[model samples]
Target: MLAPTGWSGRFWARTECSFDGAGKGSCTTGDCGTGGMECKGNGAAPPATLAEFTLAGPASAKDYYDVSLVDGYNLPMMVDARGGAGGCASTGCVADLSRRCPSELRVGDACRSACEAFGKPEFCCSGAYANPTTCRPSVYSQMFKSACPQSYSYAFDDSTSTFTCSGADYTITFCPESAPR
Candidate 1:
């Protein structure tokens, strides 16, 4: 789908889905909880790989984007900027994190973030740990970062995870292949 020049949105893949002729059904992963094929402005359920984008707008000259596993991870995903200037590098988590997901965070085919699994302030980066200085990466987020250095392993990983570009289009690829690290 095409978005306007200044459009901002997120995208993700849905797995193990079944929809009837009326476009009503659910997906095992990234369902969006709308109970239908269309998300209807609903965000994906947790344990999903997300590709978020904020296109250039009046207040900003550059576009910002990232492949985030902060909510968790269900699959490998990548985002590439095409024909952009300044920091148009590719970024993603092509690694299959589910294979190495911690036992407590494992959910069938997906992996839950530490925050989702425990709901602690340290893991969720909330309450007392709501800032970049206070919300440091935990062991689980560290492991995620080790596996996917370009992905948003935690909420405060903006420095290394977020990318920027100007005057370009993006291509989000699910299950992108890259040489093993």
Candidate 2:
């Protein structure tokens, strides 16, 4: 698919899906709740791995991307940048968080973030804990960071999690080490 210049969007894969001829179905993980193959502009449910992007725009003049587990984690993913300048580094989370998932955060093949599991302001980085200073990483977020150093473990994990590039193409690979070629 050719994304026009300045296009911005996110992508993810749904696991354990079942669809009929009419294209209606649900997935065990990353279900957008649209009840169909197409998400129809709907976002994925929690515990779904995501590859987010904001292509070069007038305001920034550079592309930004990240693999975020702030919502949760369902699988391993990696983002590679090709032919770009200005910190065009590869970034992603290739760690299988499911095996290391805490008991409280485990959801079948997925792992819920602290915010998704408890909805606490501290975990969600909301209210008084909206900023980086007030919302230090919790034990749960710390664990995620320790496992997936390149992923956005919490809401304020910007310095390392977010990456930038200019005039580059990106490849988002799910389960990068083992995905079918």
Candidate 3:
């Protein structure tokens, strides 16, 4: 069994069929075949002329969010969310989205909104999610130093962890990859 990281499935390898008589049905992501198996140049390379499996390396960080990726895997999800890959950690933690949002937003105004969805950022470093600054109240920093000491990034694009201030709506893509289908 394979574990989840972030890669989509392997591209379907094409197979070489001979027009040596009987017609068989075949097609790729794009063009559909004619009376016989027509390799209609579907953009991707055709199938292998031989039978073999090419094991690729681990899935990249983005693939996990695509519909085609993580197709076969039974993911761990929030109990109530059901087969839908529940919770932000499971289904909502993607990086790319079909839509783009402003890199920054004011705390009170609505920033990025997709349909009915809205992104209101939160300082993950608050309270239990924050750290103690003991002898230091670095006025230079609004964020309590040593707070959220570990989780501060979404690795793929290497962007900073977004935050929304009190009484503000921050502009951020609502999810990791995209909106829930």
Candidate 4:
């Protein structure tokens, strides 16, 4: 996708898909509910890995991007930013969380986020914990962070998780083999 300057959106991959010749089918995971191969502006289902981006907006020259596991992880993904300023680099998770996911949070081969697994205020960062000052990462979120330091493990992980670049093109790879060691 050719994202224009100032564009902000997310990218993700669908797994276990089975579409016919007419581009009609369903995916066991990350099914965007569009009833076809194209999502048509629809969002993916839960248990999907995400790569979020915000191109150089009007107010700032820096573009921002990150891989997110806040909705839990369904696949390995990475984001590589090149030809930009501020030392743009690659970030994401190569490790498969499915095998290590806690039993309660496991849904088939995907791992569910803590908020999805337990819908509690603390886990969801809602109610009293809605603000960044009050909200904090849970043990489960920590597990994800431990495995993927450059990615967002929870809602308020912006300080360490978000990356910045100026005038850079991005390559988001699913099931990437070159994830950082």
Residues 2-109 of candidate 1: C-alpha lDDT, one tens digit per residue: 777788889999898999999889998898998998898999988899999988888999999999999999999988899989969899999988889999999997
Clashes of each: 0, 0, 9, 0
- Lowest summed lDDT over 10 consecutive residues: which window, candidate 3? 70-79
Cα RMSD for candidate 2?
2.0
* Model 2, span 1-181: residue lDDT tens: 6677778888888888999999988999899999999999999898888899999877788998999998898888899999999979888888788988999999997899899889999999999999989998999999989988988888889998999899998898889875322
Candidate 3 Cα misplacement greater than 4 A, ranges: 1-23, 31-63, 67-181
- Superior candidate under TM-score, 1 versus 4: 1
Which model, 1 or 4, shows the larger lDDT? Answer: 1
lDDT of 3 by residue, 79-136 (tens): 0112222121221223221122233321121111211122212222233323433222
- The worst-scoring run of ten residues by lDDT in candidate 2 lies at 172-181
Error of 2 at 51 (Å): 0.9
Q: Give candidate 4 regions above 4 Å deviation.
A: 178-181
Query: Which candidate leads the pack in lDDT?
Result: 1
lDDT of 4 by residue, 1-181 (tens): 7888899888988888999999999998888998899999998888889999888878989999999999889999989988888989899989888878999999999998989888999998999999999999999999999988888999999998999999788998898765422
Model 4: weakest 10-residue lDDT segment is: 172-181
Q: Of the pair 3 and 4, which is ahead by lDDT?
A: 4
Cα lDDT of candidate 2 equals 0.89
Candidate 2: regions farther than 4 A off: 178-181
TM-score of 1: 0.95
